[model samples]
Target chain A: MADSVDTGRPAPRTSTHSLVVEAIENRILSGELGVGDMLPPERQLAEQLGVSRAAAREAIRVLESHGVLESHVGSGARAGTFITSMPTAALSRFLKLHVSLNNFDLDEVVQTRLILEVESAAMAARRQDPEILQRMGEELAAMDDTDLDREDFGDADTRFHVALARGGGNRLFADMTQAIRESLRAPLLDGYRAHEDWSGLRETLQHQHRELLAAVAAGDAERASQLAAEHIHTSYQVLPADSGGSRRQGNRTAAGGV
Target chain B: MADSVDTGRPAPRTSTHSLVVEAIENRILSGELGVGDMLPPERQLAEQLGVSRAAAREAIRVLESHGVLESHVGSGARAGTFITSMPTAALSRFLKLHVSLNNFDLDEVVQTRLILEVESAAMAARRQDPEILQRMGEELAAMDDTDLDREDFGDADTRFHVALARGGGNRLFADMTQAIRESLRAPLLDGYRAHEDWSGLRETLQHQHRELLAAVAAGDAERASQLAAEHIHTSYQVLPADSGGSRRQGNRTAAGGV
Candidate 1:
């Protein structure tokens, strides 16, 4: 069993800046600090943490990059670092690079997506939110344009999935769904551009989207879930076999091809 | 549909450091940079990107935090920033802060967990690796200790779940499952400590864990998924109502109580 209580005490092995990072994280996790709350100035933080100003600055930079904190420079109480919430962008960026780096295999990613999106589609169907439904339809319509480039079509495709995720009425699920879809955007577009049977593949995807949307609109949770799973499976199958093979081989070769 | 093709060019609205960050991210995503590839020196990078040294340094800090790069200091060929792959820790840290800050509600988190773990449990059941099964049994046995404290039991509980996740044989799913479980470690322990009838709650959890493990061991995917879902629901039901309510209220009050 992994240790449950971290105690928030920096171990001797941890770096100085990382210790500062953990100290701040402990505060945030323990609720001593919170969103919209400004952090102390670099000097004060350094003094309080008994670390150099450079270490504190590095820690702040790390937190800022994670979307947990935002720093504003100027001369005022509001100008220092303030806790912020922007997980979606940060999560997307993290997942994208990891996925690109082959830290998570393609099959694993696709399976995870299937698990999340199938449930999300079912939940969205149960909710039957008209606004989200409309957004999905609009994305479908945008994809129907025959003259649209592969990149544009991929954007519409991503938006359609994102809309379905949002329709589930769960921000966490929606954010994750969005992140995964966005992370795969480039590779999916590459798949589209590489396919010899572009028109046929596009028709297949469009038809699946229409059917999936209809299931959601009709509030058939089971049908929506099944369709979502099938749609994802079919979509991924169209990608070149080498696209998601490995970090060194697949991504490197695919990058050159693009 | 949002723009899909991020042409590596920096937009006028983007900050100098952010532009540098994106430029590097583009290379990583495009597979131009792979693991173990060293980045140019800060001065040279800044010169090449037409940005200040400070900008390059800040960008490196951001990328390093994202687990895309690692920096080493000293006067040697090996001492430089190199692309790295360590998404597990970085991803966990991001999710923990976001969950702590109430960006994702407890209900949403539990629901997401149910979706992931249920699928994960089913996958594990299908795989049925004896080694993983044995590890899970050991964790359950550890939890069987009547004298175990709330913290120790919590750690055992987390390990049991982690074992189940690993059994699924999907790195992405396992990593996410671990992150979510670890993120809620403190809150779960607090819940355990605060419960009026600790013994009764422990008995219920142990029973559920046994049943779930049996389902997995028998390779009954459907039953395993159902049991996993039920276990999660019953477990979270024991947590206080405000355990996951909001950042300012739920966590702050709970922190004080703990």
Candidate 2:
């Protein structure tokens, strides 16, 4: 494994730990498992899969980290390993780390997210599920709050877009959008803080949000999509090109002595 | 933690274990740790973080599963854990599991991917890197192979689009497209195998792939984007709507007896 790591490849997938991981994955992939469903005990899972208890536990940890499974210690319903659906947590974790390492550039992140957001707004207009629309409205109000600061506004802004994604009734789009948006939350906040005219910028953003919501409410797919694209494009264009706009601002200082 | 897990909430995230996780994550996000950078010994990390060794080890496992860290044993450069960047493996693994569990409907998957593939084609046209163009040509040739099976063609088709995505020089888009395409490889193969006019369909697909490559090579971003969108839309529409088209075909069988 170390040799493989040295050579920059993954370890062989046939290890006992990997087999346990695969066994669980096979069940999920086969539709034999799903969210809200409890797994057999760790002992039973190991026994069924012919692996050691330690291997099973580690496999559970891995799956849990993947957001495909969750485990609880006490003996009861919901107190055992169970399938879960938490794409946002896992995807955000993976993407944020990779983004921080400069494996992905800021321009690409902003552009890719813009594409998703545009499609999401279009879909939301066509679908217009009342529940999701309500959430979007609430997030809009939060963003419009007079007391909100830069960070709070950033957070609310992210939620508002995520709500729009959900309004499209596509979990995959919503989840991916959530991950991408959340991963950029800090950097975007830094961009906001660094701006010379945040007050003006915030007003423009709030106005766009309101108009976009109106488009969705009116079931105007094309207008909603156009608004979403322009909203993101303006935000990016207005933000300073330096500061936290790029990941390498702190790159040279990280010796990683820890 | 068990109580929280039982209640269907994440652990508070401030526990000793989570503290270790956060400390490591902070280092990575701060750019203090990055791809190829090694962490301290487990015992040393535990001491510095003022956490138990078990907590630190679990934290490492969690991060490792998140695809942000790799660990190995033996005495050398790669023996201990090192930060790593592997977006495809992590995202594909996560997407495949979620898709199989029907957390994302097939239509949304197809539509979301269409949105991305279209953007990727446009970007690839504008960039036209020699290496990526060569890879696209190679995949196109592989698809043109007369002896290729449905599965082989499916794999080749995925690679061609992924190559186009890479040509755009956006690791974020390319990586996301890779994850989505790879996750659908088996189902798309299933769709291809179930088709009635395999020969005719293959020819049309090969033609589209060649034209797409040509448009990309000619730097026609608009044509490339349009071609990409039509290609995916046609593929999904022409395929039988009943045959492995919906995720629910195998849904009932998955009592997840495991």
Candidate 3:
């Protein structure tokens, strides 16, 4: 497998580690390698690619960080680097960090979420999956706990949206939805803590959740989509601005309602 | 800054490097560390966090892979790891690998793209930005070239959609659109190459692009959205399947249409 890599002409200025990384990535992209496939050991890979073991090790570390490769210790069948399928957590972490760095504006993030969740809710309603409905119901019940604090309620809220996304029966959409919701977790929690009237807002939010669930249960796709959008818009109206003006200000100026 | 880490009780099995990674991630998420803020030197960070220098270095590598940090070498004001804002290529790379791994089904990816681009088209129409429109026009002209090969046309096609996305005036939405389009580039190119009647399909695609651009130029949000959806649906119909049945087959089985 290593002999297939073209090493006749090394590109000038490119690091040996990067070349190895690109060679491995090309194999994966070409469908030559896949999940659960173990890669050559550092020494073997270094020899095969005509690079140093340190370069091979660095490449492994980079791939491991991307959640594309998993390293196992010990001398056993499984004690090697294997291609892994772990997109959800990795995507969430990537989006969360970029969001924290302010690479994406808060309003744009919220708007993107509105687009995804609204579509997800509609699809979920159309599918009407009982298992997903049950999971969402459980989250709704948890959110209704009288003694639940802001942080706990926020977590349950995230779960509810995640469940709805999964119910749509589209893994890609669900993963993106999950990542966006999780990325906003910290800021949303801050907003919840700063609310002037937590009880009133909580009741309103709970009521909306119940209605949205009912829409899904009844297989009312249009209503579910509309309700999801309105819920998000209303929720954003109350959340405080993280940096500049509140999202409510931007929403009013933006064209096309929800 | 390192003194703020909660290192009172480290999990027995968790690696020290992971703990360091989490500490820095927490500081960023909490807004204590913004973009452009340089992290302490590896030695100092290790000492402050009560971890080995090797662990700190590993943590830095992980963050750098995620596009959250950049390392500058040599001795100068810029010679250190600083938080950076560069999530586009990183995101595209992640999505491409996962798509290649089949973690996300092709139909699901297409569906997600539809949800995003349809809204993007409408938003672009509503915004009607002159510069974005000019960019889209240039891409359209490039695609009109009779001598263009499959590869060049595909690249221009990707650029056209990317321009429409940027015209939507939502950075988050545009970035997601760009990443999704780029991730599907190879498969789409393959499908383009395998077609028995390239010119016929090319004409149809170019005509559809013209109509979509006209809708956007006219500021007809509904028309632009409908055109965008129809264009994607039509284009996907002609593309060959990577595995299993074609996307057209899956679309026929799936409920609801854009």
Candidate 4:
């Protein structure tokens, strides 16, 4: 509930630049300003928001980093800030840091992934899109290589999951599923690099992924979903214990490892 | 796979400020930076990143908006930038704009929600945390008011779902579930207002919510999951057709509405 936004407006408490940021974000969310719509010049925006030009510029830069807006430096109409649709990177950037710092625990990230990947696998099986299947097969094959290092294996592993998500034929689901998986990439890679039995763990993951992919390829929706869940459970179990432990121990998670 | 973050470093193509921003983000993602780690002084950071003071300041401002860092503006030891964990709003802000701009269609959004809420509801039934249940009950009761308007109902509806996610005992699940639900608030509210039979839609939603709540309360995990999925389907079915249709004509979808 704390994470939920109150639709009701609250009094501004931050700097003028943040107020300016909020002003633009509100417009985009309310659909008053849409993709490709240019914002006024820095001076005009400053005057409109009653903030300094520096504040306005700062606000624009902030939005740019979020991928919510794009800027072109020029003197003409083509050079102002424009509302831009943020890609999945915008979502993943925050998630990666959250996971890295244990703002989101390892267990919960895996849990969320299980929730998404299971349903996504089921949908992919139901759809059985050949192109997506081909993409997934390629990544799965790369992981099948016996000599693959941890870093290369990690890349292929991530792509394989993301490709499976795309087979579900839902862009938003695919993007979000990819975001969650990507957030765990660095940590999981670290886990693989540090684990006592990296080869054994890698071999186990390959087996699980191959079975899951086969289920998906055969259009066994139920089997695909169940295998997807099982794969997630196995992956979570393989993560290093220290990475799963919290610096801020609380009742949020019990003794459950996953 | 497009939404995925490539572990390989990309050549920086943006401004000096963006390079500075990237330097900070790279550190966070690599675990070199963590929560409460103080950033270097403005002048020092500018020199370290090989950027002007103004560029360094701009980069800091951008990171501040991402909620990845916080700053205290003073001339003392305790007054410097420090890494901070971003709340769910950082994720939701981009999602809201994406949905509002039709970057993510209603079908994908609802589908993603169905995946989350179903599993989340099942977990809620399994956990049955009393505090979370009571919070959910409060929201459910709030929505049960006969005189409640769409806005009030929407707020309660959101809180109820978020509470359900929390009851699952996964903080990431709760935060992400809240973020996804909040992203649709503005457009969904508009849909409610514009529809001819607002009261009828409201009543149907209330009934569906109550049934879902009852199943969760009964600690019937399978039944709760089923009911959660059904509720999502019903809610999606009730949305306006135009709202679900894409402004972009593409091969991504073939005439699916929710």
| Highest-DockQ candidate | 2
* B33-143 per-residue lDDT for model 2 (tens digits): 777888999999999988888778778877876677877777865588888766677778888887776766566677777888888888789888889999999999888
Candidate number that wins on lDDT, 2 or 4:
2
Please report how far candidate 1 places residue A134 from its true position, in Å.
2.0
Compared with the true structure, what per-residue lDDT tens digits does model 1 show for residues A125-222?
Answer: 98889999999999999999999988889889999998999888777788898888888887787788888999999999999999999999999999
Q: Model 4 reaches what TM-score against the true structure?
A: 0.85
- Candidate topping TM-score: 2
Whichever of 3 and 4 has more TM-score, that candidate is 3
lDDT, candidate 3, A1-258, per-residue tens:
111113321113155666887898888887888876999998999999999886787677767767687776668675777887778878888888887777776677788889888988999999999999999999999999979999899889988999999998888778887888888877777788888999999999999999999999999999999999999987777656644223112332343453
Off by over 4 Å in 2: A2-8, A238-258, B1-11, B14-16, B238-258
Could you list the chain B TM-scores for each candidate?
A: 0.83, 0.86, 0.87, 0.85
Off by over 4 Å in 3: A1-13, A243-258, B1-13, B50-53, B243-258
Q: What is the DockQ of candidate 4?
A: 0.44
Off by over 4 Å in 1: A1-13, A47-50, A73-80, A245-258, B1-13, B38-56, B71-82, B245-258
Residues B173-198, model 3: lDDT tens digits: 77787888888887787788888989
TM-score of each: 0.86, 0.90, 0.88, 0.85
Candidate 1 lDDT at A42 equals: 95
lDDT for B145 in candidate 4 is 84
lDDT of 1 by residue, B1-258 (tens): 011113321112256788899899988888788877899999999999999987788788778778788776666766787887777667778888898888876667777778889888998998899998999999999999999998899889988998998898877778888888878776787788889999999999999999999999999999999999889877876676666535534322211011
Task: Please list the C-alpha lDDT of all candidates, in the order they appear.
Answer: 0.80, 0.77, 0.80, 0.76
Residue-level lDDT of model 4, residues A1-258, one tens digit each, is 111123322213378888998898877765678776889889999999999998898898888777777766656556667776666777777777677667777777777777678888988998888998899889888888889999899889889999998888778777777778788776677788888888889888999988988998899999999999888887766566666334534343531234
RMSD per model, one decimal: 6.4, 5.5, 6.7, 4.7
